[model samples]
Every structure is written in structure tokens, then in C-alpha cells.
Target: MMKCKINLNPKMLNLLFLISYVLFVFSLFNRDVSDIDVFYSFTIFAKYISLVLLLIGILAGTYTRKEILWFIVLLCIDFILFIKSGVLVFIIISLFAFHSTKIEDDKIIKLAYFTLLIFTVITFLLLSLGIFNDALTNRWVGDSERHTLGFYHSNVLPLIYSYLVGYGLSSGIYKKNHYMFLIIINFAIYYLCGSRNVLVATLLLIGSKWLIDSFLQKSEFKKMINNILCVFAKIIIPFLSMISLIVPLLMNHIGFFQKLDFILSYRFTAIYKIIQTEGIHIIAQMTNEMYFDNKIVIDNGYAFLAIRYGIVMLIFLSAIIYCIANKYSDNTFVLILIIIVACINFIDNDIIDYSCLPYLIIGEKYVLESFKRRGNNYE
Candidate 1:
């Protein structure tokens, strides 16, 4: 097997990752500038430049054969789908995954947390100045104005803020201090964004943690739960990918499902429309046209993947997530964090977001190493 032996500076690589991450986050916020063309041009330029820096850092680092193979497969799929951004981001993530075994996980995580903290502060300042009012006003939030902290839309802001809350809680737990301030800030952002899905995800994460610790205190119960989850984890990717196909069919037959769809702001309707128009296939053809009537966005991440890349690609992507989740199953912090992210992906486009990809890859790498260590011990 060809082994990666590149010895890149850890600090430099961390710095590059931080910069790339920040730029990627910034690119998501669709600022309402007077010059529309200039705004798009600048955003695109910043995005690609950031990707280039991350790619350079990745190339300078070590990689394994498995990482290279996965990268090639994903790159081919992205090319077929004509998703240039996804291709670049996945390559960077693959490199990170391959090199994660050689680097300090805590250091990379701390840098990411620090970057998020700085970005949140700046966003708070901008929100205070009323600079994001125009964008806020443009969002469809049922008569009431919703603040987004200068993001492109209100729905996505809470999901982004959840990361801050997660990092803050993680830091507080590590330092042995309850971070009430972080929770307060997260609640404030949640209120501003008015996204019920984000609120549910945040509450579920916290509630689930407390429940696991308090209710599942017995070792036997814990072991049983872990065993069950391990079995589910192995098949979760393909199962969920197949389920996505069945959802639209159920919506058509069930009245309660339609009402449930309405509660989720017609997400089901949009998904159903896409399936009806596009027709479910092994590999979907790339199209620039909107799938739904009157330009309704695909809010559900699974549905989006199914529409754009088809079930095969969705299975591949979900398998990647499953690997990450499965590897980190032993660590409560990592396991819960992955669950929280996966839950949020149900209602948002976070599955392919830049903020979560690095961590997923890193976690997968950690697990892979653990397996190798076990094999060596056995031998």
C-alpha cells in the first residue's frame, strides 16, 4: 500500500483551514448590495479562492490509499452532477480525513471553535447596526420580520448558530464550567431566525444528552442501546436513501402526512413536485431549472440530494456520514454531535455544508486508526 509521508506544518494547515472555513461561511450570507452582479462575482471569487487555499493545504498533507479512492469516486459523481463546489469541498474534506490520523484532533477543533466565535461576534455587531434588515425583510416568514444576522436567508441562520452553541457547550464541558452565556446567545439567535426546525434540533440535542446521562445510568441498559445503535448505524445510509424515495408516495396516500407537511411549511409538497417532474432514477440528469413551481427551494437535504444526484449518490453520501457516526460511537460527545447534525440535515442543506464536513472526515479517520490498532494488537 502507498503511504502518505508528507510532513506539513500543523499550525499553518490549521490556519489555512480556519481561513477557508470563514470564507465559506461568509459566502453563504447573501448580502443585498446595490450592484447585484458585483456581489455575485465577489462571493464566487471568495469561495473559489478559499477552496484553492484549502486544496493547497490538503495536497501538502499526507493521505492514505482508501482516502484517495473515495476522493476519486466522489469526484466522478460530482462531475456527473456538474457540482463544481461540491467536488472541490469533498476533495478538501478527503485530504483532511486522510491526514487526521497524523494531527491533533483537539487542536483542529479548538481552531474551528475560535473561528466560529469570531464570526458570531462580527455577525452580532452587524445585526445590531440594522445592516441586515433588507435581507431579513425579503425572507418569507409569515408576516413577521425575521433577522438572519446578515445571512442569505433566515432559515439557515439558526443551523449555523447551533454550531456555536455546540462548540461553546463542548468547551464548557471540557473546562468544567457551565456556559450559560452561550446558551443565552443561541436562544437569542433562534428567536431572531424564527426557525422551528433549528429550535427543535437544538433542544433535542440538549435533551437527548440529559436523558442519556440520567435515564440510561445502568451499564446493562447502556450496552443494549449501544448495541442496537451499532447495528442500525451499519445500514442507516442505504436505509435512509431508500426511504427518501418512499416519502413522496406516502404523502400522496396519507392525509395526516399532508398536514404534517403543511406544518413543515410545504417541504413535502416541494419534494413531491420534484419527484413527479424529475422521476426517480438511479442517476439523475443535471439541470439548471427549478424543480418546483414558482421557485420554491428544496428545504430538505435528503430530498435535495435525491433530486440532484439520485438515490445512488445519496446512498454514497449517507454511507460517508454513517462511517463518521459509526466510528465516533464510543465517544459520547462525538456521537451526540453527529446525531445533532444528522437531525438538522433532515430539514436543511447542512449535509453538504462546509462547517460539518471537516469534522465528519476527521472522525472517520480516528475510527479507521482505532480499527487498525485493534488489528495490530490481535496479530
Candidate 2:
């Protein structure tokens, strides 16, 4: 990654905004996540942009030995996920292109900014239009059983988008903008989307970023954060596990007696059933119906890999998280993004784990390094 002073053109800047818009729109009407409308059209165009990225990397990576290795390992994971998850690869690719604009020109940064903004605007509009006129989420996206504007309530969109706005305003092209305004806008979107997980994720992201920034400004912050994480990693979850298991589920059903035997609840039952389905394909069918129903969808990233892919892939994922867990720094916005996304994976099941976006993050910074490397050669 080369760094120098550069800017993106307005049109290109807007592309990032539109990409976010497309992602939100894609989530709205289609329960299956395979349907597309005008939103993802640019996603089709951005595939070329990814090729351009590789071309640039090949030309300049003569000295970016580390990056080249990371890129190869990344591409291999990308290929496997594509085969396993279907169209999600495109979303990752598009995000890569969008986030790749940093260390470029002002125009390029603006392009990424506008792309996110377009998403923000379109998502709000989708909900508002539905509310005001009593229309569906997207006109093109017709009826569905889930929580679309006129559909289903997956409860994760608001969290993801809200974190996105936080990522941008916190360290984005819009860093100068009011963080409160950015958060409020996304929170409104969360309400309209009706996703509690997103709300929790957004709060955690903001709190984590603020706390880390404040404490880490002092020399002791890193030690403090590590200590806290270590404690939570060990002591807290274990003590809470029994409480979590003992939790009385709230059910809106007939007869208090039937509901009170909460020990016979779906979750406890699901645990036993998960054990039972070890040798058969029926679990897949059961999981399909449970896709976005708060509890199942918002399990750990590890569980998501198992449920969606397989136990083998889940092991690969554990190894990847282990590698990333210690390697990355928490001082940057990317670090915050990683923390939030990783936490979301613990519960939200729909995401692509071990994604390709890290390459995009690298490229954004690397472009500057590329320029620096160029400058050094000249010197």
C-alpha cells in the first residue's frame, strides 16, 4: 500500500455511497438474498474494478512481499467462501472496491464517502416511503414473510449499517461531521428496520470506540483493555453461562402453564436436537426456517460457520480469528470496525466470516505506501 496525497473524483466517490445503498436494498425485499434490482447493478461493474486492483498490486508489489502473501491467502479463502455462500462474494468484492479508495485522491475518498451516503439515504427513504405511503420496502421487492419494509425482521441490518456510519464518521471522509448526527440517522434506520441485534451492536461499537480512545490516550490504556478483554474472555462468560441457560424465555403464547415449562423451550430443545442431527441432512432444513429469528441468527461467528458451511470450515475460521486476534492494532478505525464486525459474528449468522474486506483495507493504506515506495526510489 502506497500513501500520498490524492483525491477521488465526485463520480467515483459516489460509487461507494451507492454500493452501501445496494447492500441495504438487497437485504430489504428478498428473503433468500439472491434477488437483485437496480441497486446491485454497479456491483456488476465493480468486478472490473477489482481486476484493476489486482493489476495495480501486481505492478507495485515488487517490494510489498508481506502484502502479496496476505493477498494470496486472502484470495484463496475468498474462492472457498464464494463456492459455499453464493452471491455474498459480490458484496465483499464491492466493499473491497469501495474501501480501496483511501490514500488516493480527494475525489476517490469523496467517491467512497458518497457511496456510503447514498446507502444511508436510500435506506431511510425505503423505510419512510413504506411508512408514509404504506408501501413495501422496495417497490421492486415484492411480498415476503420476513421483516422487509414490507417483509421480514432479520434484526441485523441496523446494527451493520449503524456501525458503518460510525466507521465513516469516526474515521471516514466525513470525520469532520457531527458524530451525533451520524449516529442518530443510523439509529432511525435501525428502528425502521426493527433489528434489535443491530441496535445492540451499534451501542457496543460506539461504546467500545469511545472507551478505547479515551483510556488508550493514556499510557496504561493498552494494558487496561487487554486486562479487561482477558477477564471477559475467561471469567465473565463462564459465570454468566449458567445464568444464560437458566434464563426464562419470554413467550407470547396461550396458557401460562405451557409457557412456564420453559425448560422445554426451543433453545434447550434445539441444543438436544443439534446433537441428534449429527448424522443427517434434516438439520439443514430446520436451520433454513430458523435463519433470522433473533436467537439462532445472533450466535457466535464460529456457530455461523458450522451451521452454514460445516464443522470443518468452522475450524478454519477459528484459526483465522486466532491469527487476527493478536496481529491487528486497536488504534485505528479499522480496528474498531473489526471489533464490531467480529462481535456481530458471535450472534448474527448471515455474514461472510473471514471476508475479503481486509484486502480492501490494506489497499486503501497500501496505495499511500505505494506512493511512498515510489518516492523513496526516486530519492
Candidate 3:
């Protein structure tokens, strides 16, 4: 019997991965374009195609014992979720997490940046030209008009902008002036779209980076800052998770919690109601009943993770992110980005959505590199 062999070109595989990722990110732009046949069809096709290519890449590659072990663990969890909820989100994310580490970080970042930037610019232009349908709703932040600008909601566009700002900070690809200009752009996004949480998060992220960089020349200040950040990195995710989980439970009885809930646009209240009505599960439990105002929305990301996806999945994701943040605790900018993203997740649910948190791609690369340095021999 002749041995069968199939040669794979590394460059070709990498190129295909980039294409697949771009398609997925591109599909995000048209998520709300379901009314427009051409754009809607293209977005749906892109999503399915990206998933197919990702699966192909996973099958073609060889996994180490460590990777295989991790996959098995994730698969078991996803299987439970499938059985309980009939949702494929967890499994899909597991595949992406496994496949993402195989591609070069720089290639993925560059392609993702360009793809998202183009989509953002085009969305802006189309909305400005009145060519795109604007979701002119007053549901958020009181009777003020909220503009989605062709996104899934008013918050999404600014969230994407915030992620781009985070990418600029983590990559060190933008200068001080560029970030300064971004502040102006972000304020404009707030003005036009009225997503206050995203605007606040973006500003804090940029300001934090600027202050940290400025303190770099002062050795004592830098050392002190790094020390604080090291501690912050350790607790950020857990802190956010705890607060998100706890706040909702307190929203009704406590005055402070009520004010906080009002400030967060009743996110805690929504989470509380969802938990009350639907109850919690060990694995994810799908909800056909709408949680808030006839809409199935969970604005608190950490709460969404724990409540909707189950506490087990939440802990698993939080641990993965916690490990990554601790791994690069010395890198000030990376630490700050992770912290800020965690804070944003407390206010909004989209933690694993790449368009909303592209920094996860960077985190994924770091994990793979750390594992490779260990030679993948460990159980």
C-alpha cells in the first residue's frame, strides 16, 4: 500500500485564514442590513463561508497534545450547551479560538484593522449620504434620538470605534496626535449616535494610555504605575464579573444600586429580570421569551456570560483572559487595554465578539506563543 500525502502551502493557508477573518469582520457591518437583499445575502454568505474555511484549516493542521486537550475540554462544554440551548455560539467560538492561534498575529491584525476601518468609513459615508437606513430610535438614554448608522444598534458603531482605538493603543501603531484626533472622532460618534458608555470607555482607554506613556520618563512613577497595573491586571476580570453579577441582585433593594442601574440604562434591572423569569442553568439555556421591552437583550457583558451562557462558561472565559492578562502584566499598554476592555464589558455585552473586542486576537496570539515556548509536552 502506498502512503498518502497532502502538501499544504503555509503562505496559501495563511492567506486563506486572513481572507476568512476579513469576511467574518466584513459581515459584521451588514448585520443590521437584513432588509437590503444584496448586502444581507452577502453578509450571510460571508459568515457561513468564514466558518467553513475555519473548519477546513482546523482539520488540515496538526494539534499538539495541549491543544487537543483544550479542544476536548471546550467541546465537552459546548456539547452541554448545545443539548440545553441548541445554540452553536460556544462551539463556533471554540473553533475560532483554536484556529486563530495558527495564523501570524501581525497578518491577522493588519487585515482586521483594514477590513474594519473600511467598513466603518463606508458605513459613515453611506449614512452621511442618506443611502443607508438609519435606526432612528429613541429607546436608549431616554427620549433622545439614537442613530444606529446601519449597525445592529446605536451602541455597536461606537463600540467598533472603541475597539479600533484599543487596537491602535495595543499595537503602538498610532502616534499621540492620532489618538488625540481619535478623541475628537469619538466625541462626534457620541454626538451623532448617543452611545455614552462606549464614548466614556474609549476616552478612559486613550487617557489611561497617554498618562502611562507620559510617566515612562519618571522611573519612580513608572514603577509605581506598573505595580498598580500588575495588581489591577490580576483582579480586573473577576472584579468586573463580580460587580456585574452582584449589581443586578442589588438593583431593586439598594438605593446605590438603583442609581447605578439608572446610570447603566437599567442593565442591572434587565439582568435581574432575566434571571428571575428564566432562571439559571449549569450550561446555557436558550430563551424564546424576550427579557426587556419585547427585546432579547443583555447589555451587561459579564452578566450575559454568566446568566445566559451559564456560570461555567463564564468562568472558563474569564480564566483564559485572566491568564493572558497576567502573562503580560509588565506590558503597561497591554495591561491597560485588557483592563479597559473588561470595564467596557461590564457595561455592554459583546466580550467575545471580535468587532467589539479585537484585542482578543492579540491575547490569543500571546497564549499560543506562551504554549509553544513550553514545547507543548505538558498535560
Q: How does model 1 fare in lDDT?
A: 0.61
- Evaluated with lDDT, which candidate comes out highest? 3
User: How does each model score on lDDT?
Assistant: 0.61, 0.43, 0.71
Cα RMSD of all models vs. native, in order, equals 4.6, 9.9, 3.6
Task: Sort every candidate by TM-score, greatest first.
Answer: 3, 1, 2
Between prediction 1 and prediction 3, the one with superior lDDT is 3
- Pitting candidate 1 against candidate 3, the one with the higher TM-score is 3
lDDT of 2 by residue, 87-130 (tens): 34433443443344333433433443454445445554755765
- Poorly placed runs, candidate 2 (over 4 Å): 1-114, 125-157, 169-179, 182-193, 212-216, 219-222, 226-300, 319-340, 353-379
The TM-score of candidate 1 is: 0.77
Which stretches in model 1 have alpha-carbon errors above 4 Å? Answer: 1-8, 29-42, 63-78, 81-88, 99-101, 134-145, 170-183, 210-220, 231-240, 287-296, 363-379
Better of 2 and 3 by lDDT: 3
